[model samples]
Target: DTAVSQTPKYLVTQMGNDKSIKCEQNLGHDTMYWYKQDSKKFLKIMFSYNNKELIINETVPNRFSPKSPDKAHLNLHINSLELGDSAVYFCASSRRGSGNTIYFGEGSWLTVV
Candidate 1:
């Protein structure tokens, strides 16, 4: 079984379009996160949820929304997506607390053209 999985691995849209990506994990993890990779290949965490509850949002824009329906699922929605939003999005999972192994999904590539 797949430990972590995300749908629509590739997305191409124009500026201002809204889109969403879905993610799920089967590792029985208590914490999940959404991270974005910019063109320069810098990865940054957008949101982190523990047990389906919001725990961190590192100054993520309102256009980016993270929803964790349950411990195993975390979905990301972008409203009026901009050109700057084009990047690779990754979903990850880890145990709660400090110094736990983190597992990541393949990644969702979004392009604004």
Candidate 2:
């Protein structure tokens, strides 16, 4: 089975639309995160969860939200989507604490037109 899985590998939406992406991991990791990769290939962490608790939230727009039901799952919801929101989102997991190898999902590509 895949260590981590994300739903709707591709998403196309119009400005102001609302969307959500779901992710799950079977790697038994304690921490999970959401990362965004822009068109120019710049990667940035948007949010992080440790054992189902919100831990790290970056300076992302208020339109983005991350939810973790358990240590193995993390989901992202976006409201009032904008063209700047277009990017590839990646779900990742790692052991609790810091300095651990993180595993990533294939990525959910979001496009706003």
Candidate 3:
């Protein structure tokens, strides 16, 4: 079974539209995260959730929201998508700590036109 998976590997939409990406993990990990990789390839943590609890990273915008239905799934929802939102969003999972190895999904590319 796949350890982590994200739907719609590619998304192309116009600015101001709302979109959401679904993520699921089978690794039985307690912690899951949503990360954004910009055009420069700099990865930044947007949100982290453990056992359905929200752990927001300060740098993320208010327009981005992460929802965790359970320990194994974390989904990302974006509202009023802007041109700046064009980037690759990666869903990751870890055991829940600084020392744990983070496993990433294939990533979903969101392009705002």
Model 1 gets an lDDT of: 0.95
Candidate with more favorable, higher lDDT: 1 or 3? 1
lDDT of each: 0.95, 0.94, 0.93
Query: Which consecutive 10 residues in model 1 have the weakest lDDT in total?
Result: 59-68
True lDDT of residue 22, candidate 1: 99
Q: Rank the candidates by TM-score, best first.
A: 1, 2, 3
TM-score of 2: 0.97
Cα deviation at 26, candidate 3, in Å, is 0.2
Q: For each candidate, how many residue pairs have backbone atoms clashing (under 3 Å)?
A: 0, 0, 0
Writing each residue's lDDT as its tens digit, candidate 3 over 1-113 gives: 78999998999999999999999999989999998899999998888998999876657778998888889999999999999999999999999889999999999999999
Q: Estimated TM-score per prediction?
A: 0.97, 0.97, 0.96
* Per-residue lDDT of 28 in model 2: 87
RMSD of 3: 0.9
Predicted structure with the largest TM-score when compared to the true one: 1
As a whole number from 0 to 100, the lDDT of residue 20 in candidate 2 is: 99
The alpha-carbon RMSD values of the candidates against the true structure, listed in the order shown, are 0.7, 0.8, 0.9
Q: Please list the residue runs of candidate 1 whose C-alpha ends up more than 4 Å from where it truly belongs after superposition.
A: none
Q: Distance from true position, residue 25, model 3, in Å? A: 0.2
**Please, what are the lDDT tens digits per residue for candidate 2 over residues 1-108?**
999999889999999999999999999899999999999999899999998898999999989989888888999999999999999999999997767899999999
